[model samples]
Target: MDLDGLDALLAKLDRMDREIEGDVGTIVKNNTIEMTQKVVKNAEFTQGYQTGYTKRNIETKIVSNLVGKTISKSEHSGYLEFGTRFMDAQPFIFPGFYNQKKQFLDDLNRLVK
Candidate 1:
């Protein structure tokens, strides 16, 4: 049995693993920022001038190499997203998040393959 071929395969696998480690963080951060931008751009308020408050508060946070988040800092963000008995939901977060999430997963799948 030739052990040389096995060593080459293992070395190639190691290099591929390192490349993936580096790419994962970048992928997460990019997707998170894109999602935040989408949310901010699409977050519409009936009050025209007040729209800046919510858009300005929407931000992206990189938690770690493998994790990231899009946060809405405005006090009324939840109300705007989910709405209440008197108000209909003007959703901005979920649609943006899900769209980016799907692309993120597709990117990961491509990387793995």
Candidate 2:
């Protein structure tokens, strides 16, 4: 090809490259924005749920322990039970609270990646 024809072809190729780069950059920017919004929303929800659950659990345990202590002092003072049963009952009462919190954290980690 002649010099002018070759130059024109090169110019066209450069334009195409720039357009592709611009399109790719836009797509990446949009995806980043969407992912950021989702992460923020998930974090807010997880924090709210965790805070409420923790507060309630603490309150319930405090009340239950107080009542149990009072009962033991009054009637069942002689035979007091302590150890695994009392400790194990907490996880059971809360269901999947601990596991769910762990899973939420794991999901947040994945989102960061």
Candidate 3:
């Protein structure tokens, strides 16, 4: 068996891995931000900006290098998302998640390629 330039190849792969990690994190954070915006928009569309509480409460946070979150902090957010016995479900967050998912996936696929 003969091996040459394996160390250099490994070093290159390590660097590429690091770069990909950073890029993936950036993509996740950006997508979370966009998802937040989409959720707010959907809230507005579904709820008609009654008090603007949900829209204002929707926010994006980077939980870690590769993890991100879109949070709806309003106390009534869940009520509105899942609805109650008295009301039918008017889903903003779920719709927004579905809407932004394709873009997020495309962004990740593009990054990998």
Model 3, 1-113: lDDT tens digits are 98999999999999999999999988998989899988888999656368787788888889998888899888888878888898777889998899889999999999877
lDDT of 2 at 60: 14
* Best of the candidates, lDDT: 3
Lowest lDDT 10-residue stretch of candidate 2: 65-74
Query: Which run of 10 residues does model 1 get worst, by summed lDDT?
Result: 42-51
> In terms of TM-score, which candidate is stronger, 1 or 2?
1
C-alpha local distance difference test of each model: 0.82, 0.36, 0.87
What is model 2's C-alpha RMSD?
Answer: 19.1
User: Candidate 2 vs candidate 3: which has greater lDDT?
Assistant: 3
lDDT of 2 by residue, 77-97 (tens): 121122144332222212223
Number of backbone-clashing residue pairs for each candidate, in the order shown = 0, 0, 0
Q: What's the candidate order when arranged by decreasing lDDT?
A: 3, 1, 2
* Per-residue lDDT of candidate 1, residues 9-58 (tens digit): 99999998888998988888888889988887777642321648888888
By TM-score rank, best first, the candidates go: 3, 1, 2
